[model samples]
Target: MKRKWDSSDERYFGIGIYRPKTVENVGSLWRTAYVLGASFVFLIDAKYKKKSSDVLKVWARIPLFQFETIEAFIQTVPYSCQLIGVEMDDSATPIQDFFHPDRAIYLLGSENNGLPKSLKSKCQELVILPGEPSLNVAAAGSIVVYDRILKKVNRSLLIQ
Candidate 1:
């Protein structure tokens, strides 16, 4: 039996950053987030940086929320959403092997420090990329988004 197409797999996930150090990286990641079907993009402790790039200029289409702090952000996460921290903790599982939650808020950390302990404590799962535990913050986010899209692109979703 053929399954009907499901947009459900494409729109539930969100991508976020924890005080990203550079505007360019965040901008690039935001553009990729839109391509990967993220419902929206958010920033923790965002510096209220000015926009320059074409991607950064796009706010009307993809909403960008800036949280004053991680605590405030945590409080706002949807009740059904699962927070997935992108980190390299010893307990963290490889990204390739980890199963993405249905409603995921994929969180990337600062370019210099990765995720703060406070934010890490709030996440239900931590994922590390294969071989390289630490990647550029934007790269890490792009990879996660790519993984989610790949997971959603199964036989049923393919065109005949």
Candidate 2:
């Protein structure tokens, strides 16, 4: 399900998985991000270390942004883009109800604890998937990314 990279950056949204601590999750996330046509993935507190020797590997080809702080990550995004924090909060609507943004960032948090309360406060929107107490970080991320892409693709048909 790898996506052919778009020549021009227009219309597609971005996926940001906040602070994943496992390499397995990172690999799983990489595959989904590629399929969803996300511009890049921001990995906060990424656990694996990248040795200089790993430069030419397939993982290196993927866009991975590691930030020291969530504030720094937010700063990197353009103000024009929308940021949605995925978490289980009272105000959050189901992922299906959240509107797909023309330029967006989907934030998936750490496995043990969800997105930090402080970070959640900054999000323009928050979304939740029902019926489960929790989800594996990678699985939750894939669901959100796929759902967003599906909604956008469906919406396009109505415009034509």
Pick the TM-score winner: 1
Task: Output the lDDT of residue 93, model 1.
Answer: 88
Model 1 lDDT per residue over 1-160, tens place: 7767665544488898998888888888888888767889999987856475573455766888999987899998898789999988888888778888778999998888889998988999999887665788888899888887776565336743
Clashes of 2: 0
Put down candidate 2 lDDT per residue, 95-140, tens digits, no spaces. 7678877788888888878799888988899999876788888888
Flag regions of model 1 displaced more than 4 Å: 1-11, 155-160
Best by lDDT: 1
For model 1, the run of ten residues with the poorest summed lDDT = 151-160
lDDT (C-alpha, whole model) for all candidates:
0.83, 0.76
lDDT computed for candidate 2: 0.76
TM-score of 2: 0.84
Error of 2 at 11 (Å): 1.7
